[model samples]
Target: MAKRVLVKFSGEALAGEEGYGIDTQILNYIAGEIKSLIDAGIQVGVVVGGGNIVRGVTAAADGIITRTSGDYMGMLATVINGVAIQEALEHIGVETRLQTAIDMQEIGEAFIVRRARRHLEKGRVVVFAGGTGNPYFTTDTAATLRASEIGADMLIKATKVDGVYDKDPKKYPDAIKLDTISYDKALEDHIKVMDDTAIAQAKDNKLPIVVCNMFEKGNLLKIINGDTSLCSVVK
Candidate 1:
């Protein structure tokens, strides 16, 4: 089992059945899953995306908003999700610390690598908000960056899919699920397990990444416990 890990949750996952905004039941379910990890002595850090609320790249593509402004809005949306996650974790008696790259002091502390490491060491789950505090960056990159900074053993990307597939499983009925893949192969094949930037960063740091379905109960804990059958590992 990994002693420490960083889990990347997509903003859409937080939306649950509503397809927008946070869902109370979903939040509670996620909190329970996280609580299981905490109870098992795993130090966890979370990086949540803001695509459910606002996607800077998508907005910019529409030509209505500047990319810079849209990205900033997306970053703020991440903070909102972070706060909601913090509340959910705390409501379940899990101690958590919210840190934002953009420095929303009223809601969270400034992102400091050492401070975040300390928080994890103290058995507190640290939630990283804001997408690198900059435009033109995705939360996948942010998660990889935070994982490297905090020396997490591995980065776990929680997605709707069970694992990395050769093609879009939703669209392609014959899609093949990969049990394991190399970073080079992922990049070469153009697999959409994560953004290229994030994959490259993780590769450079020699950090392994596990892609799995978060909606499946106990899957996260299983992955941490060295179960790779249900997920795809990229190293």
Candidate 2:
């Protein structure tokens, strides 16, 4: 089977120490990581969240802007991030394509499943943005949706932590890391690996979910090479 994978990145991963905006260093690092995957003959797709810019739920919390408008704004934020990643990847000589769920002719091509598949087949990394082009839907759900559409072998949720833990490792000193977890257990125990909807979708599709530390260099390569020590696999 082809080693096609979808990477779901949280918006905060792109942020700086202050956790407020895009960090070029982080972007470059992630680009390099993606480049390594491509060089290793893996087709990659990316879906990034907009929390670093603005979260729709937070925006609508004050009840000033409606949830619908806030969600749309969040979608646009993802586009900004998508284009940024595209530029970063291209700067490092990785062929890339930016496709948005919503039509934005000047910025990116409108998302088409066939086009995305073609891009992947040609060894181009496809950056999926605009969050399913629907209100009240999150980037997590968008990642799963795109992963299923692309027939990806796995969905990787790269985070600061190395793997899934029985509890919040930060708050609980005794938190135990799980090398492998079931989708049902992750959802039942609220593992926080991915959103509930995203996890459920992965379960339905029987797609394996790998959680690894994004900051760790070579972790992606290691995990893909069957290094179980580096990640937690949810299946």
Candidate 3:
């Protein structure tokens, strides 16, 4: 198992079947999964996206709001998700901390690299909300940034799909699932495993990323246990 890792949870995954808003069952399941990792002696940090509430880029494309404002709104949405997850974890008796890039002192602590590392070392799951506290950046980038800052052994992106594919599996009947792929190959092929900026950042930092399906029971634990068959490892 990895000694330390960062997991990126897409907001959409938290929404479950309803397609919007947090689902109690899904939140509890995810919290349970994180607790399992913690119990196994793996230090875990999380960066969550706000796409379920509002995708900044998508909202901006609709032309009602500027991209900057939309992004900030999205960041706030992440904090909401962070808080919800924190509550779920704590309710299940897992010690967790919510840290935001943008200050929201009443609820969460400001994001500090040292403080976050300390929390992880003390066995607290640190949830990073607010995507880089900036516009024009996806949460994927934020996840990579946090993973690099915390010196994580690996970045695990929890998605709805089982693994990275040559094409969208839902759209392509014969899309091949890649067990392993180079950063350059993933970027060159325009694979949607992650945004280009995130892939580039991970590549530059020599950080390996595992893309896996969060909905699959015991998958995260299996991935941490070095079960490569359950996910795609990108180096």
Candidate 4:
């Protein structure tokens, strides 16, 4: 089993059924899942996307907002999410550290690689926010970057679906869920396992990416325990 891993949760998932804003119920559920990883004696780092509140691309679509500004807004959105999850994780008796890529001394510490790794070593869940502190980068890329920097064995992409499929399973009922996929194959086939940038980074770092459903209780643990039937592995 991988001792250390980074898990990425989409901001949209936080909205749950309502489809906007952070849903406390979903937030608490995610926290509980992270706690399961911690209890399993594995070090966990978390990255949550900001799409529920705002998306850089969508905000910039009208052409009034510059891409740079929109991306920054998205980064800030991720920070808000980071704070929420950090709090939820702590409320359940899980030790956590909220660190942001952008300097936010008021609520969290600045992102520091050594400090983050130290927290993981000490068994605290380090929540990474602020999206690489750069514009034009998605939280997916940020997740891969953080996973690589912390020397994590794998990066987990938590989604609504069970695993990566040939096509959108919601649209195509016969879509085949991949059991395992290679980095190059995923890139060439245009699989939506993650964005191209994120996949390339994981490929460079040789970090395995596990795609699994976040809402399903025990799914994270099951995938980490090498239950390939439950999720897809992108390496």
Candidate 5:
């Protein structure tokens, strides 16, 4: 059996057509991929971002509230996404666990690394949310933290683009994509793939990260099946 993996999905990926909220079609497709992985005997965990609902820095920049408070709200938003994803997974007959960094007794249990590992051991897909329960830390940092804690073999960051690029691929038609990159180079180039804190944490923990576009069919499974050329790997 392959090692357990932590997959991180961004909020934008959840936006199927209208560019916001949980898209049922996309959710079902993601759930199917996760189910296929589980069927193949690969342990899976997820860390989901809440940007589709509300963004902390953006809200604060709009003078809606203080940065810290807005970020907390963003964290709450993640719980909502987590719940939605959990439901999607369970609806497809996949066992799952939703662990949150913040304490919301009504929604799910608080994050405990040991408990998460135990769940993974039992073959249940664990969904990690709430962004470390701290302000100013992106969900990317939370994914790295959870992946490190769970001893995941790989940190799979599912994004809109296929892989890391010198510039925003959506905006720059001529942006160059890197198939394999060193963490040091990613930092030097100030790549928008992840925050410095997240990349640093992954590097410090010696965890390999695979960045791929989740929109592609079976892309997640392909990456785990040793298709290194399909995505960008950071070591």
Candidate 6:
């Protein structure tokens, strides 16, 4: 049976060859990959981050805007990304829906767990936008929360790196990638890959989390296909 997977793609992953903005080539690639998953009967949900465009915390440091206001701005950035992804997917003939935490009736439906589930069951790929509708929470936590609420089988975190490493692989010469690791170990060792809150949420829900490279072609498909040995799995 096809599993219900919540894919959390970071903004950096969408940077593609140019390293900024929505790269049409990469979006099409991702859309094609996701369409394959939908064709194979998988229920797909996406939670995209907005780091490529703006980060609330970074803007809050200038003292010009309050943290809450900055975070809200970041949330809006996610909505922009969501619309881009929705358009890309729809252009490829994939049925897609964008549900936001912030109510914007003109763009997409406000996020309701049950309604989102219904859409998934009906074979529509649902894109979850807007952070938790809260200021402090990161999109990582939003992904974890949504995955738990939607009863997804796993949270597939699409990162720039292929898998989770003991340290920042780019900075360290001997960073080791783990094929499988426990949530306890990730917390105790301070992996720094995701926020502690997000990890804790996933651990509490006992949802399998896989960290993989989104830029690599067919990686997402392999993940949904249950190739556990291919990526870093946090159990």
The lDDT of model 5 is 0.90
Residue 58, candidate 4: Cα error in Å is 0.4
Write model 1 residue lDDT over 120-226, tens digit each, in one string. Answer: 99999999999899899999999999999999999999999899988888899999999999999988987786999999999999999999999999999999998
User: Per-residue lDDT for 57-113 in model 3, tens only?
Assistant: 887887889999999999999999999999999999989999999988999999999
94-189: candidate 2 lDDT, tens digit per residue = 999999999999999999999999999999999999999999888988999999999999988999999999888999999999999998998998
Off by over 4 Å in 3: none
Query: Candidate 6, residues 166-232: lDDT per residue as tens digits?
Result: 8888999899989998999988886766788899999999988899987778888887777766689
Error of 6 at 90 (Å): 0.6
Say which prediction, candidate 2 or candidate 4, comes out ahead on lDDT.
4
Global lDDT scores for all candidate models:
0.94, 0.93, 0.94, 0.94, 0.90, 0.88
Off by over 4 Å in 6: none
* Model 3 poorest 10 in a row by lDDT: 186-195
Any runs in candidate 5 off by more than 4 Å, and if so which?
none
TM-score per candidate: 0.98, 0.97, 0.98, 0.98, 0.96, 0.95
lDDT of 5 by residue, 1-235 (tens): 2479999999878887788898889889899989989988888999999988998998899786999999998999899999999999999899999999999878898899899999998989999989999999999999999999999999999987788887887788999888888989877776787888899999999988899988788988888989977799889
Candidate 5 or 6, higher TM-score?
5
Off by over 4 Å in 1: none
Model 6 deviation from the true structure expressed as Cα RMSD, one decimal place: 1.4
Q: At residue 28, what lDDT does model 2 achieve?
A: 96
